[model samples]
Target: MAAARSATLSHLISTNEPPSLFEVAQLRRCVQTLVPRARLLWAEYKGLEERLQLCRIVLSPTRRLPAEILIEIFSWADKKTLLSISLVCRSWNASFNVVSSKSLSTTTMRFISEDGIPCHKILSWLAKPVTGTKTLNIEHEVSYREIRCKCFKPANPCPWAAPDFLNLLAKNPTPAQMVLRLKFSSPNCLSRLVGGAGNSLLWNSLETLHLQLTGNWSGRASIYRNALDGLPKTLRNLRLKINNPKDRRQPPPIEVPEAPFNTLKSLGIECSWDSPLILSILRLCVDLDVLIVDESIGRHTWTESAAQVTLPKVHTLRVKCLYLHESEKIFPLLHLPALASLTIDGGEVPFADRNWVLARSLRPLGLLSPMPRICLRTLVVQSINGLDGDALWDIFSHLRFLRCLVLQRVPFEGAGFLENYRRRTEGGEHLLPALRMFELRDLDEKFDATSFLCFVKVHRHATTRRHEGGHERIQEDAPDGLRHISLRYGDCKESRKFEAVREELVSMVGALERDFGVVVQMTRG
Candidate 1:
């Protein structure tokens, strides 16, 4: 009788019913009555009973999913869903803690508050062992002096002062795969952070480092040199940018150690002037594969002086000059046997003087004698005032292996420039042999009818021939033939000229497609 009554109670509880509060109460009483001895059983196995009751209430097959499966489900969810899951119950909270620990491991902590309050919280969090942190980026704006004042205050002295964050880093070293960006308002703060008691600890595990120094502080290079002198030998990449004039005046000449970074592969530096100083620093990075020098100071003359410095092994070089004079000497530095790409900005070559720049620029290519066939595949030329289209065409003609050519503010002074361009290439069978992409920006309506037309016609005709080796050798009847042009026109201010230029460009593209069967795209600014 007791067994039959217990079975009956189980069936009633398991059924999917819209039971009232009274019905639920009566059901509980009936179940208890069915198994009076169950009270003793329940007391002896209280945890199991509670779990069984919870399973019936929340995990029954007729209802929803089981807790374990739901936990796994939440694990696959994104940050938003996980946050929502955390609010459900104690079980979910614990589950969330486990998943969150793993998910947040990839995030770097950034303290953005200007005041010291956030700094304290960050320090507290960092004080604990960060076993899972892969990268730590600290972009706090708090001044070191402020932190020192607060931590060293007498009223309620904190044992872990501002510098303790560094100390903690030193004491509990993270894995060597971590990357760090430590930006500071002043060099002094950077010095304090790196050279303090935590100095040895913080840099030991760093694999990549980026430092941006801003504000009124001077002597950043000195501070950086001192702070980074003993950095981990494992550093693979380094980027340094000093924007403040005060700081630029005092950049200490980098004292690169012999094989300073045994594993360093890339180095990028942006500052004003100090080209010789920069050259000296670059020599130390013997194994460097990429080098970017963006320093504009002291009239264009500085560039000429900078160009005199030699970089023999650099594979990639990007230079932005204020004046065009220095550009004349860039070719002589092409001792780089492996140079594959080159970019120059803010240089203007006159229509009459274009050949001079081209000849000198090509001198470096000549230096690679036995391998005179240098595989220089990409070239970017940006002119501030404008480049004479004829001179540009002449320049492109010489770069036999040039694959990409970009012209900024190319000057098309009416029919003269276009006629000169056409006259030079009229008899020549080929143009930019390896050129596949061409871009022209900041042009006027005249550019569309003359300069654009001449380029398309010359290259289109040349490419149709079988023997043509330049950009002109497009496959006959092939849809992918030579001309793929992007033209950008217009000034910042609005003008009626815009509509005229657009119409001209549309007509030019239509003619090219209809007459030459070439595709051209026009985009307006």
Candidate 2:
């Protein structure tokens, strides 16, 4: 066997030309003659050489980075950078394709078409690779030229009229459930999109819809109604914002179907000057889990009777208005038995009003009810113009289950602002036993830091007393005990006051951490 192996090794080296069949046959015969260890070593050396070559290529600086790393770099880049990255090279182009496709998977397309329709190139780019976009926004701006041009030249197509674009959507049926948000400034463009001869049918697959009417909204209610009539059954969320400068000549109300959205869970509406239309929507979207109403669209009178209308089903409510008295009256009408969150902004309720009986009585009466006493877990109040400390204390004192409280742009200039806060934190008036998170924003320099520190100190002392007496001990850890404090100071141009305020805030945070072991985060804007 050893002699046979030696003969095979000699045959292998004896080939002058690359091995032919006969040479390979002779080498195999020789391998049968050699010991097993030499054969194994020869095979292993070939494998090592191949691996070393691969490693050199991988570690070479001139070699292109892996596709995954390139994609990450693109993700961190902005839109302009994304465009530039696409132009780099062939490998980069392929990498960009994969990265851009993934990035646009949840992308929102918002068109500002006041100047003109989005160029065809943009539409073509969107239709390619079919990246399954989840949201589409189209905002059209109307101007004097656009109105006059369309009126005089009826034959000429308006720049924003893109039936072809809508058709493109039909061609590439993206699998993602989508949200279509459209803001239109031109009534002509709106009519073209949703009128009798419009393309409302293209929105058949939408899961969420948001519409904002900015220009000539009065006469366009018919157009909107027609558009809504074609809304897809899959829609689960809806938001409408209408701002009509010509609201003085009241437009005829659009008769919307009650509970227009059978599967809808969220609804938001912002109208400049009308409540009847808003009321119609509220009555129709009965099964909504979230509702938002913004009254800054325009000034209009709203009454308590409006809230009396039964809501189908709602678990969360957010209201932003300038009138607190009117808002208070409406709160009782909301049937939100399952509500776990409530937010109020710019309400007129006097912070010191001691009318707990009235306030409690106003809780919605019906199958839909506010959560049971202490069931509400989150409450936010912001931009309240007239509420003082006493009024806020009175309101907050009753919220036994509130775990988070946020105050923003709250006017604390009233006569007894500080005093009322002190009273609430004192032994007899202390409330919010379950409160774990507190946030304050847009506070003036003088009171921002000092007042906050004082409040924290009072609460800390009260908590210590509870622990000492063997009562239900308050937790020492934040959120668990009362964990986080967040403060956002509004931008003040006065540098001197800003500096002083910063110093005071630093001192306040230091004291809290040193004494109570609470975590505080401060943000300046």
Report lDDT (Cα) of residue 504, candidate 2.
63
Task: Count clashing pairs, candidate 1.
Answer: 6
Model 2 TM-score, 2 decimals: 0.62
Clashing pairs in 1: 170-201, 433-470, 433-471, 463-472, 463-473, 463-474
TM values, all candidates: 0.54, 0.62
Model 2 over residues 12-32: C-alpha lDDT tens digits?
Answer: 578765766865786777667
Candidate 1 per-residue C-alpha lDDT over 116-233 given as tens digits, one digit per residue, 9 for 90 to 100: 3244554454444434545556664545554322321135332223555655666766554556776665545555554443346656656677776655544324444553455557
CA deviation > 4 Å runs, candidate 1:
1-161, 167-191, 197-208, 213-228, 232-234, 242-253, 258-262, 273-275, 299-314, 323-334, 347-374, 409-416, 426-431, 441-451, 463-481, 488-517
Give the least accurate 10-residue stretch of model 1, judged by summed lDDT: 147-156
lDDT for model 1 comes to 0.57
